[model samples]
Target: MQQDRMEARTAGWGQRQGWGRRADGLARAGRRPRRVAMGAMLLVAGIAWTAQTLGANTTPVCKLSVCWASEADKLRYECDSGCYFESNPVDVEPEAVCNVMAEATHEGSFSYMYRDSVNLVTTGIGNLLASVDDAVALPFMIEENGVSRRATEQEIRDAYNGLSSQSAECIAGNPRRCNTANSYAGENALRLEEDTINQLCQTRLANEFTPGLHRIYPDFDSYPSKVQAALYDMVYNLGEGGLSPPKWPSFNRAMGRKDWQGAADESNRPQLGTTRNDYVRDLLESAADEEEAGRQRLASCASPGFP
Candidate 1:
């Protein structure tokens, strides 16, 4: 009886060991496939991320080639194939800064004309009558409903036709003539005026200053957007031609040298007065400082790699 009990006990032990080994092998087999699937998923995700990064780097870059729309084609379109200026919708970064500065300096008005504090015949935001003789220039485009685009010539012509002799007269204190005497000055006329002013402001900057700046600095995009804004205002106040020659030789020289502070100081000259010169200088420097700080912050940070 003792010998039979020993043999039976040994057989049961062998069967248990065999079952344990099979279970361990099955678990390892299941885990192998799980590990491979996880690695495959990671590889695919890495490839997609790399592709996205390359696409972002490949976005189209633009630079102004033509100065302004020719008399033959007074209107310019956005994001078109040609040079940056001829392309529709100017560069997003600098254009925003320019628009804000201009809007702040010049008030929006429809058929409203007055002698600015500087005693210039000014109409609309940044449309100096002293600089541009006609309120409406040809080949100008207006976006319908203030959002979508409308035909350039027809809209401008309609706005022009709506005007009477009174609206046409944009002289000093007699600005009220359009308010009372004209059939225009309604919502439609105001929309047209706003469109015209916006277009002209952009065109003048493209035509006059952008190309020269781009030529001088390869990394012109890195410059403070406010500098572009200030320059545009200068163009608006003083014609593009006026930026050079007898009036601002020092300022022009400083700009040619890429001397930002020197240009700012030249801009702050007392002759132009604190209102025009100081205001613009502050705008330019502050914008530059802001852009620099943003760049620094980006440089200091580490990339947050794919989760």
Candidate 2:
């Protein structure tokens, strides 16, 4: 069934004919485009193998078409169903990461600017606009007399300043208070489109948090999806520096040794709600279960076949 699905999806690309003709011409010229050929073969085989080995219930991580210009380009980057791959392949499903973050950050309520707990201007799943420049960098929509238009730099700056100057009490769990006519509502109201918010989140994860995660956890890509998500959550919630060895020594030590349960025990944060803490702990525990199952599988494989 998985192979059938894969074949059905690839059928359209195969029918393009242009690719076939190009391949043929290159072959006839004795420059066989081996990398393209090899990449195509690997992509199909890899997807099939991954689906089979991980079981039908498992989500395929790399379902996007391979569009690399060369083998070197392939090595440097690859696109996935929901995220862009960097130099190192992201093992955890990008959708899973996004779901975890969206839930933890905004609970699926994205759009509109608001001040966070610390009275810092924020929007779109905890995206912080620390300065007026930060606010102006992204596109924001402003509504005037029921018509929406793109906000100018001055409007964005004014909104940022207005939100930034609000009292902590007004911002503490009161987004509506922060969005009054004076600040982010009516003529002064500024909002981000959902697509822009999602793009912003993805770009940050790909460029900032994920790379920092790889530096601290060299074997990150080899971990189970749950483990990777848990670690990624930590890196996202707390910046890379906040979760690094110096800041989180115990947790870092547990992670270094692949002690999922130990990491779970050390993963609690006073600032985060209990639900969020429990979510991280549960993910780590689930990873511990996966680790134990893997150990049992290896042990069974090592036993004599005729025993």
Best by TM-score: 2
lDDT of each: 0.43, 0.61
lDDT tens digits, residue span 85-194, model 2: 22232235444466567874423445777755567667776688787798889899977898989999998887777654555555565544543322443434678887
Minimal lDDT window, size 10, model 2? 78-87
Clashes of each: 6, 1
CA lDDT of 219 in candidate 2?
52
Candidate 1 lDDT tens digits, 104-175: 433334334444434454444545655332534433334556564533555554544443333344333344
